[model samples]
Target: FTPLLLENTQAYEAGKTGTEIPNVVHGVGVFSVIGGSGSTLGLIIAVLIFGKVQAERTVIGISIAPGLFEINEPVIFGIPIVMNPVYMLPFIAGPTILAAVSYILMDTGIIERVCLSAPWVTPPILYQFLATGGGIKAAVFTAIEIVGLTILWLPFVMISNKQNVSEE
Candidate 1:
């Protein structure tokens, strides 16, 4: 259902003719991809740097490739983010915050609103570029989103680090 974020991009356009939104609407399709995969990559790096748990490592290994293409099932299901309390907050909050930032950026004209609908399978930075009709600002915004999401994922990752070390 995450791919639905990339669907119906044009619905954001206030004017039907132009590729640009001209004005913000429902923030529909404003984000190129959901933040899950980005957070997953961030989690992977966080685990590698600070986590000692082999279980975390295994899940991270399983998640890396799919996370690249914006697929997050391995991380979501493997980490069991569905019902796990430790991972849930950041998992939900990071994307919500990023979406707000994205909406602000586009609304303020710092980044162009999405003009074209990119396939959900498109990679992160590249997806932003294509979604914005080759705008570098969108790509830059996506890079920033990745970094911020990574930071948001850190405390939770460190929690895992501590939890794992304790159980050992």
Candidate 2:
């Protein structure tokens, strides 16, 4: 995924340089992680976008948490997050939006205690409900997260459309 993503990155950079590098390349191992880590990332994203949420307190940021253990990229790829339309939107949008909102809320004292630390990997709606002490159901969060991710997916897909394209 990083290579594929870089394919687009290099292309964009080359575009600026007025050179035709024809950057991207594709092959097997495409869907290899789809069933495993991709699903996991999808689940976590589903939870955040549609589920509970995060940010701030430098030592306690939700974004930086999974990253501490080098667990983030798996979710990024395992959820097959890079290209799958179903999992892509929330993977990008949910985190971007949540990071901003959480930062503002914490900085403004709107919500405190800094989220502490919740499990990094849980199904979308279930994680949300659990994160909130099981105070809610999955249906509502799932619907909203789907919309959020979809909105995110639109622009992302449009921009990086052919970068990592795999017909497999």
Candidate 1: residue pairs that collide: none
Where does model 1 exceed 4 Å of error? 1-20, 23-39
The digit string of per-residue lDDT tens for model 1 on 16-122 reads 32234454443334462353433565666566676687787888887777887778888888866778788888876766677777777777778766667677677
Per-candidate TM-score against the hidden true structure: 0.80, 0.34
Q: Write the per-residue lDDT of candidate 2 for residues 17-44, one digit (tens) a residue.
A: 1123222122111111111232233344
Clashing pairs in 2: 37-78, 37-79, 38-78, 38-79, 38-80, 39-79, 47-51, 47-124, 52-128, 90-149
Which ten residues in a row are the worst by lDDT in model 1? 1-10
Candidate 2: C-alpha RMSD to true structure equals 19.0
Q: Model 1 Cα displacement at 32 (Å)?
A: 7.2
Determine the C-alpha RMSD for candidate 1 after optimal superposition of all C-alphas. 4.3
Best by lDDT: 1
